[model samples]
Target: MELNSDQIKEILPHRYPFLLVDRITACEPGKYADGRKCVSVNEMQFCGHFPQQAVMPGVLVLEALAQTGAVALLTEEENKGKLVFFGGVKQARFRKQIVPGDVIELHTEIIARKGPVGFGKATATVDGKIAVSAELSFAIAEPESRN
Candidate 1:
């Protein structure tokens, strides 16, 4: 299903300047998700990343992938209102630099699930070429007030 920014905000906790994903193109509960982040010169990170030649950091790209996975997990009615926190990351690699004006496509697939924790394999691409890939794990946290 396609998700707009407002719908995405309902599923994710991140806000502007930190919310990396702009929208979700596709999603399958407990399975996989595809989303995109439009890198722009107005981003706060652009100022410090490099003044002359700003490049989106590799870590941020990975975070974007993770956020996509979180949206996949949290959009389910059973997981709503829970916070998805990064547990770990493995075999992360950056194949190319992502700069302003690039549209990054993130594809994530679930690899494993155990109670409140889940694992996923994600890839970020630009123009059909991979820019980053990684195996990531996360855990769901229910805020104290919700419990």
Candidate 2:
């Protein structure tokens, strides 16, 4: 299944400058998800990260991977409307610098689960080269009341 930015917003709470994933190219509910993030010089991070040499922050790349994993877990029928919070990240490695005009391809697969907590294997690639790879842990939680 594929999801547009609007559809992704329905599954994720993030918005505006914080919503890093621009599109989900493939998704398998509780199994895995493949998404994309189009880096741009106009992004707020680029303004300060390095005005002379803009580079996408490594943390944001990890966040994009997390969001892709969340989409995989949250799409399940039992998880709909729930929120997934980062429990931990492990074995994270940055192999390349992501810059403006790069299209980050994010992929995540649910590797294990026990009730509300689970683990995922994630990777972010640019131009077919691995930019970041990590193991992410997450916990499903009820959304807090707005009022």
Candidate 3:
């Protein structure tokens, strides 16, 4: 399924300046999803994250990819209303710097699911070349609790 920004908002709790995944191009429940995040110079983070050479932070790239995974995981009836939080990140690598005007294609595939915890591998690509990749784990948390 393709999800626009509004639908993405419905699936994710993040707001502007923080909401990374701009749109979901494809999604398959319990399997994988493809999304895009258009990086712009006007983003709030760009003002301070090195003005001379603004690079999209690697952490936000992971977060963007993870958010795509969260959308895939949370869209299910059983996972709705639950907040997916980062549990762990392993084997993270940044191959290239992502700068303004770059459109990052995020791909995430679920590796395993045990109760409220899930594991997946996510990658960020530009022009079909990998910019960053990581193995990520997430846990579903109640809306009111921080864990």
Estimated TM-score per prediction? 0.96, 0.98, 0.95
For model 2, where is the 10-residue window of minimal lDDT? Answer: 39-48
Backbone clash total for model 1 is 0
Candidate 3 lDDT by residue in tens digits, 32-144: 88999999999988998989999999999999988999988988778888888988899999999999999999999999999989999999999889999999998987799
Structure candidate 3, residue pairs in collision:
none
Question: Across residues 1-147, which tens digit of lDDT does each residue of candidate 2 receive?
Answer: 999999999999999899999999999999999999999988999889999999899999999999999999999999999999988999999999999999999999999999899899999999999999999999999999988
Q: Cα deviation in Å at residue 19, candidate 2?
A: 0.5
Q: Which ranges in model 1 have alpha carbons more than 4 Å from their true place?
A: none
TM-score: which is higher, 2 or 3? 2
lDDT score at residue 80, model 2, on the 0-100 scale? 98
Report the Cα lDDT for candidate 2: 0.95
Of 1 and 2, the candidate ahead on lDDT is: 2
lDDT, candidate 2, residue 56?
A: 91
> Model 1: per-residue lDDT, tens digit, 81-145?
98999888999999989999999999988889999999999999999999999999989889666
Q: Spell out the clash pairs found in candidate 1.
A: none
What is the clash tally of candidate 2?
A: 0
